[model samples]
Target chain A: AQSVTQPDIHITVSEGASLELRCNYSYGATPYLFWYVQSPGQGLQLLLKYFSGDTLVQGIKGFEAEFKRSQSSFNLRKPSVHWSDAAEYFCASKGNTDKLIFGTGTRLQVFP
Target chain B: EPEVTQTPSHQVTQMGQEVILRCVPISNHLYFYWYRQILGQKVEFLVSFYNNEISEKSEIFDDQFSVERPDGSNFTLKIRSTKLEDSAMYFCASSANSGSYNEQFFGPGTRLTVL
Candidate 1:
């Protein structure tokens, strides 16, 4: 079985500051990782995905994540945060079954 | 950009009643799936449909839950008896039926509230 863990349940950051959201997964083989953002009462919006090849994958909304196989981590990072970035972030990973297992999620509150 | 589409953006049903959620996947896509996110929780997979049949489903997708592609373009999720716990955002997603790499396009989601 595969599972995902997002260490931070909630995070608050000031606008223009760098941000990092941690994500770790437990899977037997190489994991297919993804980051999704959900606004209040809305459906998920795909942020990015890392399947194979390049470890560092860039995504929309000025976000990116690096896949560290040995550490079993795919942490999301941004150089600077914007107030609009405040939302719930979820990290999901899939393998051979192609079934996505999502983490608990990290609530980001960006303040100006 | 081509994207998945879902109907009845919101549905309110009484407990123990049957509720069906509908979706229209991208025209070129071949694989479809249904996922739900309970309030303040992660999105959980319910089932995956492909080739006019079910390819996979999670434990949460028990006997009470079923999916069907009734026609050429519609995919639907039917819950035999709606429970209060079933009130959540139901999302329909689709991909090109190739592999796990191509990102899945998601619909706006149907917010089901069972009272």
Candidate 2:
């Protein structure tokens, strides 16, 4: 079975500061990776996805992630975060069966 | 923009009662999925549907749970008998196809509270 791990349970960042969320996956073959952000009382919004080709993929809200095959990691990064960026972020991996295995989310608190 | 939608933002029901959660995927989407997230836990896949049939299902999807696309637009998940453990946020997602090009579009989840 494919699984995903998010090491950080909670992270706090001041507005305008940089942010990095770590994600790792365990899968036999190359997996499709994704990042999603969910706000209070809102649906999970896709941040980005990595299927093939480029190792670095860009997403909305100035977010980006680097797919490091050797590390089995797909960490989301943003140089500057806004106050609205505060939300729960989830890392997911899609198996050959096409099911997305999500990790425990990381709750990001952005302080102004 | 086109997006998936779920109805009844919240539902409260007694244990042992049956409940059905409804969702409308984006028009033209071919692959549909149901997932649930227990409080403070990861979102787990329950089942996937395509071609008017189930394409895949996780172990969590047992006899107690069933999914049906009763119409061209509506996809529903039914719980035969609810348990306290069943109280969680249920999400519906749809993809244009099984191809990698089309990612899944998630709907605002329906929060089910079993009393």
- TM-score for each prediction? 0.96, 0.98
DockQ of 1: 0.67
Which ten contiguous residues of candidate 1 chain A have the minimum total lDDT? Answer: A36-45
Candidate 2 pairs with clashing backbones: none
* Cα-based lDDT for every prediction: 0.91, 0.94
**Per-residue lDDT over A1-112 for candidate 1, one digit per residue giving the tens place of the 0 to 100 score:** 7999999999999999999999999999988999999887666789999988999999999999999988999999999999999999999988887678899999999989
lDDT of 2 by residue, A8-100 (tens): 999999999999999999999889999999999999999999999999999999999999999999999999999999999999988676688
TM-score of 1: 0.96
Interface root-mean-square deviation, each candidate: 1.6, 1.3
Instruction: Count clashes in each candidate, considering only residues at least 3 apart in sequence or on different chains.
Output: 0, 0
lDDT tens digits by residue: candidate 1, B1-115: 8878898999999999999999999998998999998877788999888898898998889988999999989999999999999999999999986566757878999999999
Off by over 4 Å in 1: none
**What docking class should model 1 receive?**
medium
The list of candidate 2 runs beyond 4 A from truth reads none
User: In model 1, how large is the Cα lDDT of residue A5?
Assistant: 99
